[model samples]
Target: MKRKDYALEAKRFVDAAGGKENIESYLHCVTRLRLNVIDKTKVNEAEIKDSPLAKGINWTQNQLQIILGTGVVEAVYAEVQKIMEVSNASMDEKLDNSKLEDFKLQVKANKETLRNKSWFFGEIQKGMRVLGDIFVPIIPAIVAAGLAMGVSALLKQILNPSGEQLNSLLWIIVDIVTKTAFDSLAVLVCWSTVKRFGGNPVLGIIIGLMLVNPLLPNKGSIAAYNAQLDFYNNQLIEGLSKNEIYKAWVEAGLKWIGQAPTFDANGNVITNAVMGDPITAIKVWIIPITGYQGSVLPALIIGVAVAYLEKWIKIWMPKAVNIIFTPFLTITIAFLVALFIFGPILLMVEQGILIATKAILGIKYGFGTAIIAGVLQGIVITGCHQVLQGLEMQLVIDGSLPGANGAAATGSIFNAIWTASIISQGGAAMAIAVKAKDKSDKELGFSAAISTLFGITEPAIFGTNLPKIKPFIYASIGGFFGGLFAGILNVTCPGMGVTVIPGLLLYTGNWTKLLGIIGVNIISFGVAFLLTLFLFKDGIQSKKTKLGLKFEQLKNKIKLDKFKIKRKSAE
Candidate 1:
């Protein structure tokens, strides 16, 4: 009956983890507090998991991740930091000089790679966490950009009934705000990667900027050209070939005279677009070699290369030239290597991932999508789901691609499944709320469930569903059905990140797809809710455990509350 105190909970977590002396460093993410401890033996796993505040807990990559939902994690993290600092000062005073350096060494060791072994699961975990470190911070930018694009798209449909494009200053400003994030996203990725790898961010950004330089043709232009070619090729008439049609149009409009090339998945110029034009390096090479704009992997590899290269250069590059020569040498060597080496290799890897993921979604009968959605949340349990952000962003950015039977493929299919998988958590949590007898527990369940309607699910998953296990299974089942329907119906969104109710704002201008997505979401939620309520196996027995009454059943609840209050006072 006492109010919960996060600070007190934080102190307990630290004490259970062998105090501040054992912890090397600590930080918090959206749903968990990650502690990098010096000695894993010192951590008390059983005691930590026993705390009421902890929703779930796991150890990976030599770091202890305590899932404490969302808001509580932040508060607890602050308390943990304060406790560590205070304890650290006293511990330093007590330690002798001989042991100090060794302690510092251990701390430093924890800060670097702390994976268990080279060939063990630790390396994969380390890579996944590094990926998380790179992409997690930039999620806001992706979401904001997606929302702006959605809003702009909705306004365009309403304000321009004739379907004429708008180019007013205000619209241009909106374009700038939204486009900058995608267009310049490479810089953000490079900057983040460099910082994570202990290199100068300014230099990282310079290398990033070089990738999207104006000298190269824009990637968007190439896509448009490919789409146009596809269109003309299909509409062949008057004995004109695809190249002939494109050339005629070019000649008609002298305003444009440039190479038209179709790039393969690996960024190679595989097709010549214009008629009678030789596939010369001067013509198709520039496009492949041009700016990466909106790319992820290329910039990422280049960023890491530059970071390590810069760090390596600093080892012998004398202090006098630290300012000028170090940057120049690092940039020069890294740029050449990226352009000549990592650029081609990484492009293939990036394209392969995109194509492979889409290929899975493109599987017959929606089995691939169903499997992905079923396992997505389980992946979130390990915090490695951040790796999917890039694929989702690129899919959304690609808009609708040409598909069979005059129906275009949806741009955000992955996002649609993601939303469905996540929304099911809300349903499961609400099911628990419907079963809770204690007012506080009921409130916590309801609040956590509601939070998921806006795209946050950790609270619902950790706080309400994970405790019983059945609710989690029910929610995932809901997601599986939702995903199967989503893929079959070709349900999709205009963006990524946002989901559920607010996600509706993105479904504008397409009633069929919108309705389809809404239906799947409902199916996902309803199935989970109904399953958790009716077929919980021991549903009746569990209800007697302490859940509150349903709204329609509140009369009995009132009498029950009064009787419990009286009994508590007497005790």
Candidate 2:
């Protein structure tokens, strides 16, 4: 639905959730506002779900997650906070107090029922929530930067070839805009992580900057240099010899990253294989000083450790000396430990994960990638999708490198997989909308379906498809088929973070890949739509309930009683 006033809608949600007093704390992710309430039963979920503003609602443990799509969720979250602040002074508040005793009784039964959920999965979900807290806040920034880079790449392709006057000037400006976010990604991660853990935001920013200081060797550059050297040294190129064909090409740009080796004890130059000949061993930095640029794991670990340490520092230190000593101790201790201890350990772990992911997704036939494509949405459903955040970001970082077009197209393949799954769920919702006999069901399904095309899928999943099990299964099948084709075609994108229709921008340089993802969209949507329409009867809805009428109808009953009292006096 097109929005009314956001503040008024926030009031509706707040009122439906018993009252402002029932809420304890709340936070928002990309497409949902997760609120922790003192009393779960006080939340009139039916009213909230039926609201024109809400796409759906679900609970993970005690936290109520309301899916409001992407653009609206943030606005509504802000308004809700505002509502909480002003609610006390408002004499006209419409909170219904009639359900108080019933709510208390229901709260007990709700607790007993909630305990049936698996304790193991609950703990795992809690960890995933922490990951969500760290990553989801920066999602908008990443998406914006990724799209900016997409535009820059398009500008470079179109204007660079023609030697237009605007080419270099425009490209330089856009390049600067695009590179800043990913170039300082570790800093963002640290900042988000510390904020998630309840530490001071300023300290988080300081620690993050320390992790990515300009004085240190550039991490991404060194990795690129090493990766190229390893590929040449291993002689893995089949049917073509790099010695004869690539020696000149290699010398064109690869000569400056390392230096000649020192002589060994016997006065012989240390040598290693290069291409067809042996050369003096490449002397690189022995004592590493590289800063993590596009890394997430190192910053994540350091953020957690420092957050707790800062809390500890405050426990015993005299408040008198705290002003002088706190900042000094935190910065110095975090800097040294990050460099010498946590940094190395976490980097090694990050390297292992990166290598393993590349090996699996980079398999010869794209079989491994195809499997990931088919099942990733299932992972999303489990709320374990947060676990893949590192993998997905690494893919985008690797795929955006200069030579990735000639590589296996890892980023694009993973993106296509993601896009396929997202849109398939949307297609299923669309099918339900199209075939529904009830007007309310059609409205619900249509709203959810349309949001998914913009790359938000939780509404379609939670509000429509998952409640109807067959549609969810059919959607996954559609994704599998679409992703299988995407894998075979080796579709490529410059980056990730956007998908479906808007995602088309990522492939603007290549017509064939663009057409290929278009094919993915059509196939995934078509299959899911066809299956859901033909097989599912009556479409997606509860038989008796009207989503948006519940709360309003309840309020109307109170108005009717007051009117009856007024009429008796008039008679």
Candidate 3:
């Protein structure tokens, strides 16, 4: 067999896709190289599909996706990016007036396509891709932290049972590893968000640091701080409430700004007349803005606003003064908006989602669990699964969701569903591998299925199950049952990030839950495999054709090698 040259293949891919100039932007998710091209008509879809390196091709959400297996996709993407940079540099050196006009025209066409009714959904899909790009870079650190926390929990159960204090260096190490990433999650999120939104990442870091400033009261201390503040001149105010404290702060602000508050008939300050309804509401919910340590949405919202504000400032200010003014105005505006408006609103939204999730997953007989598991893969296909990152992180930090019998479990129920869905995809891929008659098809299927065991299903989903519709359907059905079983057992995950094989560390202290998770995987795999084998016929026939071709190629290769040896001996 000939060794594959991924770099060469990547270059060919670039040319077939109408060169680097045609590419607007490109990104990869697990298994596929997703490219947004300036002109879809210019892309040679047939050439891309015919490439020996490409496992499959999919056109979805207004992006061209070329399926390359998990690890291979990353390598191909790097090579492609390198090629584009070299190509672009060369074009810049030889640039002329007509070429410059052409470049501008291409940019204009790209912008026009964004507003076209045909491409509206494509633009929305790009939003999801942007979200993925922001968080994907930070995932490794988060996953490592979660794993460390899980290990610490396990050590506590084994080494310090019954709450016996065993203060040791080992415990300190565990604590450091567990807290470092999670405690400063906002900082990481801010850096990534700002970079994605085309702003200075350092400004994003400054904003993130402010959100989680050491001087700010921690979330756990907010209540005590509020109560302490309720005292005026060291005299405790009787019947003091959070609302009253907030009102006092707002009134103090009014006075500082040289405005007098108007009172109503009951001697109460009319909040609407003083600062309007929206600002009043913001003030009331201000207590929740202490820190965004475990939050995602708030930092993202702030980063977006900062990016736009910085751009606007640069446009209006003189070049000589813009440097100083841009950073100053950008941070000032972003920080104030985050502190007073977006932060509180997003906090409430986060709380609401948490509350709603608990209610749904806490439903009788694990109905919610089944539904979430069943639809989760579909969500991933549509690129909406990134939304779960924040939810899963919050759930893991919260430790456990409400369950029956007042029993608090030690892991995330949401993660359990994710685990089931991921494993089911692997199972579906594996079944296709088993039923495949062609050597190439079997290899692709087996590789994709194996990749899923490590909690990466893009290879399995895009390379195998997606192409065979019935397998995907069967896998989803398997996921639902697996999730149902997990919910019934009240399975909990100790952390987020890694799922499936590596996720076992999260259940170190709870063997029963671990076994239940294993059972879920087995059941999901079994159901998906059986359903795909019995129901899908196209997969079987496709394999047979490919296998026969492979055999013929192998025979021809053997004959050629023999002929070469004979000729060499005669010479």
Candidate 4:
């Protein structure tokens, strides 16, 4: 491959996209530079596609995405950011002489565009966009953690096939990587959410740390330990349930400020009317606020409110006292709101989703599983699939999913479905490679197919399948059937992350599950390949058919005109 100048490419991209002023915001995923532009007309699409640096361009979700291959995107993005910063600085210097009213008007217009519409569905769209912005940046971390979990499971399986304990230092190291990444996920979510919502991320980190504080009772350990505690006076006493313990501790600490729960007839505690006010209710409800261990929803809710509150405080407080009061008030108010209101509500919502998912997967005959598996990729495309990671992590910790019996074992039904759904993408890409008429298209198809096998499908989806509608449809069909089979087999891996080729490690000790996964991949690939090859044809073939029909029609029309002229001459 010839070496290309990334700086020049970055400059070309900026220039073609109508310079810094036209850009609203920009971010990058694994393989694309996604930019939200103020004016689509200002973008020079032809120039961007013709540029050697860009692999492709897509305009969707109100953003212009320039496809730059992985590993190079980071460098290109850095260069682009640098160019934009320089351009902004120069603009600022020039704007010193510009009218202030124009700047104010521009700001006002931008704010209006940013404001959420009153329509409920429109607000939902905005919420989804916010989630995508916040979560996309954190996906790499989650993926890394999931891979680590898989690796740890694989190592344990290899060293201890009988599920015996391993005292190896290497196991400890592997375990650390898995635990630290998945266990502290709430912190990452909080940090990302705060930044996305325009609040100080440091405050978010503090809140997250408070939620997962080591002093709080661990939900997993409390259940087992509660059984070991002694009963007093025929009543459970001296036992630390996760909720009861935290609530009692908080009441004890705030004894001077609020009243504790009062006992009623039959020694049952009256929770609702405790202390004759909502303060007692808030204090007693503190337990659910602790250990946001596998949760992102709570962080998101808290961040959204906190961002507004922070802004409000800045507006009201005097500049001299703002430094002293802003952080104090922001933290105090946000934490209270999170603990008293949003925490319980969001936790219930989270629990509801978990129960709903479990119920769906628990259905006999695999009907529900098949439905979920079929649409898993569609969910992924909309970016809602990232939310499932929290559920998967919870499953890993609980060891609830089937085939996840061993101490080191961890898995989720979501992981199995995702794996099944992804392989079909590769299969479709392979078929395209074989059927493509253009050499460049064929090469891209081959590359995308290989990339998808390793669990990266953006290249395949964007580069090949999406551009050709029929191929994508064929691939989706393949995914559906493959997912259905996975559901029927009740296939489960020991961990999340790194599907397809790298996912083999997650099923190391479970032969049946491993075979099931292999079957799913084979079926998906074979079905997609056959469907694309036999049922779908290359774009060139379709074009040729259209051209042939047009030629025939033109020929017949000329013959008819000639006959008319002959008749006239004869007369």
Candidate 5:
């Protein structure tokens, strides 16, 4: 149905239920309509069941629950909220000051108080946090350098096939862009993570370069020195800065003292350090560092400390930590975890996966690629399916992984289901549209028909066919068979982000792949329709027609004339 019509029809159902005054509390969890009502006696249960607005209703003590299929619940909730004020009711009949009453008052007072915060800011933060958890650790070197390599490959294919093309004038620019772009993926992740964590992102970005820093001079030299910076004669040295020296001093002092330490340097250490070489100078100045270690490893170590500390703080000072503190704590915790744990773990996993792939499937790259893409796609899409689609685009753009062959394969499987679902429901929708005794079913049929064609099956699934459960099972079974066949056939697809149908052209160039795609679509749809027809009763074949009632007269008798809208002005 059109959005407005759906809203209107839902409102009709609400108006039928004693116009919202009968409802005590309203809530939706996952799928079903969970409600608490004031006067159960006043509800017309038979009217609702016969009206076609609800598939079924069940009364379980305090709750009045209704079933509307997926995608339709949001519209129902939105319409009901407009017509009524559903508040939580206290269970304790004797309690003078109930928690439910207090919560109701709080909700009334705090309407739009929290959500007035910027949506864009929240979305950006959420996106960045997701990236930090999934991408930031391995991003610094692998993705950055890989993208650069992709460009280099493209350039090499086009302009530098052999050694002869390298001397060309354009090669210099291509070489620089490709080389630099490849390694910047990690840097981007670092900066984005720091930015999300409320740090000076510019500093975070610059610091990320330490991974590829030329200043270290030798491999793992900084780690070998335990990141100790040496100064000479109380003057600044070339390798270590004044800040580095200060940090080293603080760390050394902290080690000597159990608690946080302070430095007293005006007389003894300063005077002794002025006359020595870098080693002697550092020795005279060193004070066995204590608590705060600001180096990367130490920051990570402290971050682990902070995680445990925050838990205590939360309980110790509950009033001080509310929703407002969530962002701050999240940032701090993420910063430490990313630096210490996530970075190393992600790097190791990514490296191992890449190395293993190269070793085992370097020759049959296509087959290996398809299996990874198809399997992961299936698993990821089961819950909030869109996440895999988003990740596929990111990985491809980052260039560490090959293009989205896995994504395409998985999407194709899902798409087969979508198409089959629409076709299977077509007969049912037509039946309801043709011979339903109630005007409501005819209207619902019109909606189910359109929604199914566009790959939305909720209305048909929940409203007409799916409550029976047989159609849904059949659709999924057909989809699995069709999807598996497509995979085994090596139906290669041109990269089209995630949506499978959009990449149909990728298979167009090859007749075998094209034929396979067509075959899968046909099989899935045909099987679904046949199963649905056999399992479900035909809605269109009316006994009233055979009983000598004229079609137009029957339709006219059930025709909907006008809708009744409730007046909030009276309330």
Candidate 6:
């Protein structure tokens, strides 16, 4: 029906149902009108159903539902709100959106206000979007780094038997490639975050590449290293601070000044009438003044100058602000936030988590590594996996954690859980495909398989397993056994991710140990699938619900007329 007719249709229904005063709280979910009644006697549900408004009548677990599909429910809800003089105490608190259009406009304006604040926040938002976009691709890159390094002896032989001719070039190339990939992971993560937020991906990539470029001399060390060698001192000091060259210049000047005593008044060498303290004053003081100018002092002066300039820019930028100026402001704010806020917060969080984990494991005698691993394994995976990534990157930068342990572990977990879920769900699907009688059960069986593969287990869990009792029992039993086995193996994870199986790659150097972990997961999945199949075969077959004799009498009348017509036509 057209929406124009809904108001009139709703008014008629409300009037028939005791002028809406009889209705108490009203809510809607999916297919039904959830209405709490003031007086059940006043509500003629049969008449309400017969009034050409509602689809059907049902009372389940205290909910008096008026079923209506699609547009009809919304139309009815709107009209009811307008004419129905609802009692405040009896009304549902959530049926308050009478002026939805106005509220929507207000919400939009508020969002715009926030967006207009500064360019910096916009950049942050952009970075977040970029990060979200590239989150998946980075996984493969991380895995490649690990694979290039030797997996344990079982997976890959690091020590080759043939000593005939070692390929030094290939070895060197691989080493360089892996090292470079591992070193710049952070820059990639940050750049991706920015790109996802709508900034240029190429720009972000450029920035990332620059941040970790090892070829670029570190600002602090170049000066010190160049000062020792004469050839390097001349060439490299040109690039270093003035202070670096000032000391060298100061010493040469002092040496010349010291010998000035022998020079005559007209710049000729006086020989006998030498100055009293030309060398002492030059050696002790004048050179040091020039030395300070050449070194850190100039850099410090420049930094102060730039900082004041930035402060002044901030003060003036807001007055001349426009849409174009917005990007510049946002970029500035984002840079500050990245350098100050995000960077420090990430570092501290990473350190805290690492410290806590180490402390847990470092306990003497009383603590079991496997038990600690099991307890923390899931907890850390939820949100704290980022912590491990941060720490691992920090370690790599510091020359501590080799390669990318954090990323590798994450991959292993993703592969492991993914494989186990697929196998288990596949088994359930096969069993249901063969044994289930009811159409709903058979359909649910297929859906369960699909959901499991995608990592959303709610429907499979709550709808099928928990309700059936047998599947739930088996799954819990399986989870417990798996947890126990995982605990016993002392499987240590330096990283975390989605899949359970591939996460075993975190222990790549210990291929035997990884296989042991994989074996345990398989056993868990196998036990759950086998037990569930054995217990639920009968349950699947006997799923029909017998309505009471009173309700059963109405079945023929409720059945669609098409079936009746077809039967009569056939006869």
lDDT at position 286, candidate 5 = 32
Candidate 4 TM-score versus the reference: 0.53
**Model 4, range 431-534, lDDT digits (tens) per residue?**
98898755655776787777666666654655567545567778888887887788788777645555777676567668988898898888888888899988
lDDT of 6: 0.41
TM-score of each: 0.51, 0.51, 0.51, 0.53, 0.31, 0.32
Superposed Cα deviation of residue 181, candidate 2 (Å): 2.5
Candidate 3 clash pair list: 411-493, 412-493, 438-543, 438-547
* Candidate No. with top TM-score: 4
lDDT per residue (tens digit) for residues 378-448 in model 3: 76643234435545644553353333465654657876898889889888888888887555457767877
Ranking by lDDT: 1, 3, 2, 4, 6, 5
The Cα RMSD in angstroms, rounded to one decimal, for candidate 6 relative to the true structure is 22.8
* True lDDT of residue 409, candidate 1: 53
Give the CA lDDT, 0 to 100, for residue 372 in model 6.
36
Count of clashes, each model: 7, 1, 4, 1, 20, 34
Which scores greater on lDDT, model 2 or model 5?
A: 2
In candidate 5, stretches whose alpha carbon ends up further than 4 angstroms from where it belongs are: 1-42, 45-473, 494-501, 532-571
Candidate 1 to truth, TM: 0.51
* Model 6 Cα shift for residue 474 (angstroms): 9.8
Candidate 5 shows a clash count of 20
Candidate 1 segments whose C-alpha is farther than 4 A from its true place: 1-97, 100-132, 136-143, 161-163, 236-287, 346-363, 367-483, 486-515, 521-571
Please identify which of the two predictions, 2 or 3, would achieve the higher lDDT against the true structure: 3
Worst 10 residues of 1 by lDDT: 543-552
State the number of backbone clashes in model 6.
34
